[model samples]
Target: MILTLIAYALLAGLALIVYLSWSFSPRLTVGVAGLLSLFLAHGAWKIFRKPTKGRGYRALAAATTAGFTLTAATAVFVLFYGAGCGCM
Candidate 1:
């Protein structure tokens, strides 16, 4: 389904961002994670903006939003919790 593809694409995009960031600066991994988290949240928002007439699509959208929310929260925690401590 289209929604599934969109969700996968978002996941792939986040993974690519993480990979690129890690390759470029291992020291800034937390910052990159936070950025990717924001991106995921944005993707989730976009997904929610689409109108879904079926229960399945609604459920999928909810799951995607929840996953993105968790990622964003974890990223923020990692960013602030690892600041200046070099605990990446």
Candidate 2:
């Protein structure tokens, strides 16, 4: 329960930081998001590999998976459009 809440809070904090950085430097934001996507991909892989224990674990896994997907999408988008944005 508490652990899940903490995980969610940390995830939200990371996303919020990345989002807020966009206005300052889109390239920097994309770089950070790319790094975070890698980290979260590893986390999601580890979580999915483990056996299910409880609802909290499953919920955390789902949240991590979603975060990973979003960050990855953001990183990929930057790769396609970053050169034209003047931030690259």
Candidate 3:
């Protein structure tokens, strides 16, 4: 469980670094973001499944902290930062 969380954190870090090179490497940025999201989802699932309950809660707390940065950084790109970025 802890290993999964650590892997997620590492991917999150890579995504942040990739975000800095956005204009020059948009595809890489997207790739890293996708990886981070995958790991987070996997970790969350593992944490949820464990028999020990608080471990999941604690992991969720940590994930939320890590996820805040991801959302803040990528919201502009993925969440329709503008009013009409083709969304309905």
Best by TM-score: 2
Top-down TM-score ranking: 2, 1, 3
The runs of at least 3 residues in candidate 1 whose Cα sits more than 4 Å from the true structure, single-residue gaps closed, are 1-43, 47-57
1-88 per-residue lDDT for model 1 (tens digits): 5544555555557789878878889879987668766767765885667664654545645666777878767656545543434433
Instruction: Give the alpha carbon lDDT tens digit for every residue of 1-88 in model 2.
Output: 5544554555567678767898789998788878877769866695568666654545656777778777667656545544343533
Give the per-residue lDDT of model 3 (tens digit) for 15-65: 677667797788887888788777667555544664664543566556754
- The numbered model that scores best in lDDT is 2
Candidate 3 similarity to native, TM-score: 0.36
Candidate 2: lDDT over CA atoms? 0.66
Ranking by lDDT: 2, 1, 3
Q: Please give the CA lDDT of all the candidate structures.
A: 0.65, 0.66, 0.59
Where does candidate 1 have its weakest 10-residue lDDT segment? 79-88
- Runs of candidate 3 with Cα error greater than 4 angstroms are 1-19, 50-88
Where in model 2 is the C-alpha error above 4 Å? 1-57, 85-87
